[model samples]
Target: MKIKSLHHICIQTECYKESKEFYTEILGFKVIKETPNFHKREYNTWLKLGEIMIELQTAKISTNLNKWSSLNEGPVHISFLVEDIHEAYEEIKSKGYNNFKLKNEKEIYKVENGYLFKVKAPEGTEIEVRDQQEI
Candidate 1:
């Protein structure tokens, strides 16, 4: 068997409203489908970002941390690749998401590929935005 492509990523969020708004309003993902009572859960929202899809559902447990520790678990972070790093940074800044300190004091970090920055979602999930230099 061979895997073709990733269909979506599921995120369990404690606060459905905030998470929905964050992914839709802030991150510019389009809503494909929304179920108010999915499998007895509070909500299940399917969002699309370009070719990728994100499934946001009500979480059974609450993690009251400010942000999820990258070292603590299964999936570390979800990253989005952009064309312009500066433009993405400015856009995020203009939207008032200034709490982007991860690893270092600076917001954006330059890597071998390009540049990236991390932000915490409503459930403390790490959302990374980055740019890739053409090979």
Candidate 2:
């Protein structure tokens, strides 16, 4: 068996509207397709950012994100590559997003390869925006 590349990341949200806004408006993801009543659920939206797509689905039952704790069984967080970390951070702040946790209390934290910042999505998902560079 062989693995090619990551196609998409599926996110189940209790409220689709809020989640859609966060991914679209805040993160600058474009809505590629939206299917109403998809798979016996309220709706399913496909959001694209560069070459990646995020499958945003509506959960039939209330979704518990586990508060994004490290003890969770699934993914701990989602990270995105951007051209400019400072621009992304400023844009997010301008959009009235203050729920992000900065590393070491710095506006833009330096990682092993590049700079980045972490923000909490509406569904309590931690999203990392990193500067575009080799990693």
Candidate 3:
């Protein structure tokens, strides 16, 4: 089967309020839709950033809730293409997200075709901000 495009990335979080605030307030993602009490005691929110969409879902089964870590075997990070890496980093820091650790000793690292830096969301989800333009 040929995939046309990425529809969305789904993230399950135990701290729903923190995750929601991080994505919406800190990262400036807009909420396209929200379903409160989606499955009784859980919330489901859809956020949009440019053409990318992310679905933030609260744990449906309490017993199955697990926290994410760098040691996890599945997807570890999500990267977004920003227009300016420095401006983006400054903005995030200015908004009191000072806990972010640089992916490299340098504030920005060079990729094959871009520059990138990583930051952890409130729940420790890795987020990479990149600019795909030669410096």
Candidate 4:
């Protein structure tokens, strides 16, 4: 079978409020829906950024944050296409959310069609922003 398209990316957050703020206020994702999870104790927030959708899931029970690591074996990162990588990177930095501290002169890498850089979400997930041009 062939995969058709991505429906959404689900992120398990240790702190739901921080994750929501980072995705909404920092990254500019809009909240499409918010509902209780299967257990009905915690919340699951559905967010939209352009055509991309993401689900922020709150842990049902208290857990150690140290267990989650960006370098873990599961889904490592999420990438987004931006109109201008430089402008996006600058905006992210100006907002005091540049956990990666990427330098434009060294960190931003050139791809076949554009440039790419990575930043971290509040939960420490790597979020890549790429700017591509029609060639």
Best by TM-score: 1
For model 1, the stretches where C-alpha displacement exceeds 4 angstroms are 60-67, 133-135
Tens-place lDDT per residue, model 4, 1-135, is: 999889999988877898899899889999999997556438888999888899898776655546456677878788888888898888877888757636566668887788888878877788878887454
Arrange candidates, best lDDT first: 2, 3, 1, 4
Expressed as tens digits, the lDDT of each residue in 10-112 for candidate 2 is 9888767998999999988999999988867788899998898999988754444334465788898898888888988999999998788856777678888
91: Cα error in model 4, Å: 1.8
Measured on C-alpha atoms, candidate 3 has an lDDT of 0.84
TM-score of 3: 0.86
Worst 10 residues of 1 by lDDT: 59-68
TM-score to true structure, per model: 0.87, 0.86, 0.86, 0.81
Q: Indicate whether candidate 1 or candidate 2 has the larger lDDT.
A: 2
Q: Report clashes for each candidate as comma-separated counts.
A: 0, 0, 0, 0
| RMSD after CA superposition, every candidate | 2.8, 2.1, 2.4, 2.9
Q: Give the alpha-carbon lDDT of every model.
A: 0.81, 0.85, 0.84, 0.80
TM-score preference between candidates 1 and 4, better one: 1
